[model samples]
Target: MIRKTFAAIALCAVISSCKNERRYDRIENAKWLIGRWENDSRAGKLVEEWSTFNDSMIIGSGMFVTGTDTVFSEDLWLEQHGDSLSYFAKVYGQNNSRKVEFKMTSSTKDQMVFENPTHDFPNKIVYRHVQDSLIADVSGVSKGQPKTEHFAMKKK
Candidate 1:
């Protein structure tokens, strides 16, 4: 009789522990994500950035931190789709009203690609993140061609 009672107690404890396990947070509630991310080259030139990601969207803007334009007016839009994030960006130009659309090609733990099929692009954008900095390059493109540059900054 004592053995049966102990088994019942063990089963109840196991079930109680399982019920107490908490689920992970939702994607939108990720606080560690909302911030600025900056990237620089070996020569110390700011290449690109993620300015900020908040309210279920990623904002990337032109980098003109130096010169007279410290805050670029143009920004790209990125948001989550399932486990992947998709981007559709415009020049976000001040008074220019120009726009562009880029769709996702692939994504991994440390890399992502965005492209527009109808637009004239050399190739997909490739990013390598190391520590707090992200490196960017374009594959399947020729020399002297313009590729997407990245410098991600998280919101302080």
Candidate 2:
């Protein structure tokens, strides 16, 4: 009876460890982000475009225009390495050469969330697909106060 009890406890430990492991499907989760998404705001007209480069990678570009002037732009990448997915951004004019990375925390068919607690401005990034529209939200703490920004985008 003691031998059987030990075997059962060992099996339970293994199963519990497996359940605690993180499992991610980065390619499948990123498939919905492909194509162009745009929005017009007081700052300007913002556009984001995403394309699939391979099974494990998606590339993105963003541009902001005000009247006839191009104000801002950035390059982004989503990639899966091993069992984790990371989101990277390289914005022009500010740290353009180095890419800031955010680690993906959760993903579903229509939503994906990433987080980087060490970042100054944006610690969390979330993307959601609702009906025909897509939503992007960024949130973080600024000077011990919480701040969040949301952008509603539509395919173009």
Candidate 3:
């Protein structure tokens, strides 16, 4: 009976450790996003700022400015819950100003992707870091047509 008990305890320990490792890996993989980025164009200037909220959370803000007028803005959050990572965005003047949650579908050393298929648009959001630039892409079906937007920004 004692031998069986020890085996059970060891198995539990291994399971718990694996869970923690997964969570840690996700948090570590996204740490590179904690910085300011910007993109300038004749249409407007886009800026995104990110900071560490805690060991398991990162907070961000983004906006677009055109000729001193702010056109778009949003609050963003990347958080780890248990062994899962999620991205949340609350865009001003959209969806009653409520936050949308997207589950992390894939992550790598320089890229992370999130998805929410139920959302009306932008069912997928992807972020990739390459050299000195950050690329963001959002895509989904809008009004029965597939659409995608891409934003490329330099570190600021």
Relative to the true structure, how large is the alpha-carbon lDDT of every model? 0.52, 0.87, 0.93
Q: Considering every candidate listed, which one attains the maximal lDDT?
A: 3
Local lDDT at 16 for model 3: 94
Each candidate structure's TM-score, on Cα atoms with residue i matched to residue i, is 0.51, 0.79, 0.85
Model 1 agreement with the true structure over 1-156: per-residue lDDT tens digits? 999999999999999777444221122332233345554444433434453455456566545454444544456556765555556556554325666655667765656676655555534555555566555554433365655544453222
**Which candidate achieves the best TM-score against the true structure?**
3
Distance from true location, Cα of 21 in model 1, Å: 15
TM-score of candidate 1 against the unseen true structure: 0.51
How large is the C-alpha RMSD of every model relative to the true structure?
Answer: 7.6, 7.1, 3.7
**For candidate 3, what is the total of clashing residue pairs?**
0
Over 1-156, each residue of candidate 3 has an lDDT whose tens digit, in order, gives 999999999999999989777765677789888899999999999999999988799999999999989999999999987778999999978989999999999988899999999998999999999998999999999999999999999998
Q: Which tens-of-lDDT digit does each residue in 13-105 have in candidate 2? A: 999877545333566567889999999888789888999987678999988899989888889989988889999998867754788999999
Model 1: which ten-residue window has the lowest total lDDT? 22-31
